[model samples]
Target: MDGRPMTFAKMLEETYTDGIAVLHRGKLIYERYFGALKPHKPHIGMSVTKSFTGVLAGILVTEGKIDPQAPVTDYVPELKASAFGDARVHEVMDMTTGLEYTEVYTDRNSHVWGLRRANGMAPIPPNYDGPTTIFDFLVAQKKQGEHGKAFAYKTVNTDVLAWICRRASGLTLSDLLSERIWTQIGAEEDAHYHVDRIGTESGGGGLSTTLRDLARFGETMRNHGRFNGRQIVPSSVVEDISRGGDPEKFKPAGYTTLPGASYRNQWWVTHNPHGAYMARGVHGQGIYVDPKAEMVIARYASHPVAGNAANDPVTLPAYMALAKALIAGG
Candidate 1:
């Protein structure tokens, strides 16, 4: 893809894709599975869960339960002494909150592992006595720099936002998601989130859903939040996320593959000609929506690498190529 030719099959193989589905104008065009994955099985969504949390927050905002301009402490006074104490709700939603936590997946010692351990995603060491629950882990975070100044891809930000959502709506993350999105989309199967010690859902990276349901959600976004004869997500929330955040803030993040891209409400906005945006997860899971071409791609993968850098080189170009082809003929 970078000054070289690659086939679609080669891209899928190289990225270690497990399953993928493509929809155009709300109709399934292609579907396939590989490796140990089956059509009805639910694969872990990784960070894609953050997008769901973000959308849920947006819904609460529209309901007048959450004020984007309000300080994080207003909702969760428990975080008043943490890094999010001084952060605004919008900053957390956009991931612009400056926190000391780092997310270098290659580094086993990175703060992300601690988060995993706290959120029940990773096993805790016998001697390790860190926070065993998501709330404890979040309350211990320290501020790194000025909030709302630059973008940082830290998972804790989403967790904090999830706490805010819960405080405002008086509902757990799982129930809020089910009531607001899953059932509204007429999901083919039940979706779930892994929970921490105290039964709090890991809103950052703990969701699991089938590939077809993922495509349904993707198509819902492409159609301005309407799916299955109903408006699942408010159009205004979709519009705000699709509009994107300031690229200047996102520039410092240095995502080489996503030039001129911005993270808004946990979704990555490409700002390309197609006005494409995506909900991405570690290890190649993603829901790519290209509004211009009316195409939605839902993919679940188990790439050997944990970051999108390993898959974007091949996948991004391939997606654009398919969009171009569809625009030309289909």
Candidate 2:
């Protein structure tokens, strides 16, 4: 990536990339699958689902059914005693709720693990007694600090958004997606989210989709929510994400790999010269949209490392180099 051709095999090995698809000038330029991943198989999108949930919220926002400035409890009163009780809808969208939850993966006691259990992602023992639904897990969270004071990456915010979406629109996450985005965009396959005991879709990290489908969604976002001759997502929503949340709110998150980046509507705005932004998740899953170069790169990976820091150094440079090459060739 440093002024050299990237070694595809070497980078894939280093990052454990399962599937990748790249689009240039609004057309497919590259694609591949590896290591038990297939074109038809739907791999877990992880937190990439958050971006989808965020976009769906945008659809409701456009309909005048949901207001970003409204308090979450206005939609879901169940959160009245939790961290999200007094948080604004926009605060949840921006992940600044200041929840007491910790996401330490190695710590079995972390709130993330509890989230997994509640969202049907983890196995439950016979004697296990805890929150049995994503809603239950979310309502148990306690406030830790001042809301809207800082940006903290937490999965529960998306779950809360999903709940609000359901309450505001009277549609489940899966149903709303199919009715609004998936069907309109002409996705190749029917993607799904893992649901809890109560059949509540895990809006935070439960969606699974094929690599090509991921690219389609990324292209939809790149085109400002227009795809397949339809307005699948509102252009205003995409514009808001591209404009990004407050950099002052994002700086304290300590994402050294993402200097000058901001989180908005669950997308990461790089704020680089090319105006690149991305939908990122744990273990290297990402949908990078490079608007300046007119390119989109969708990837589904199973890297052994869960943190983006493990692969961002290699991936980000390669992505920019590809974007530059695509633009220069034209």
- The 0-to-1 C-alpha lDDT of every candidate, in the order given, reads 0.93, 0.91
TM-score of each: 0.98, 0.97
RMSD vs true structure, all candidates: 0.9, 1.6
- Model 1, span 205-318: residue lDDT tens: 999999999999899899888998888899999999999999999999999999999999999999999999999999999999999999999999999899999999999999
Quick one: best lDDT, which candidate?
1
Query: Over 4 Å off in model 1, which ranges?
Result: none
Residue 326 miss distance in model 1 (angstroms): 0.9
Residues 1-330, candidate 2: write the lDDT tens digits. 245556756677778999999998679989988889999999999989999999999889999999999999999998999988899999999998888998876688988998999988898868989988888899999999899999999999999999999999998889999999888888899898889999999998999998999999999989998888788788999999998889889999999999999999888999999999999989999999999999999999988888898889889988887888888998
| TM-score, cand. 1 | 0.98
Clashing pairs in 1: none
Clash number for candidate 1? 0
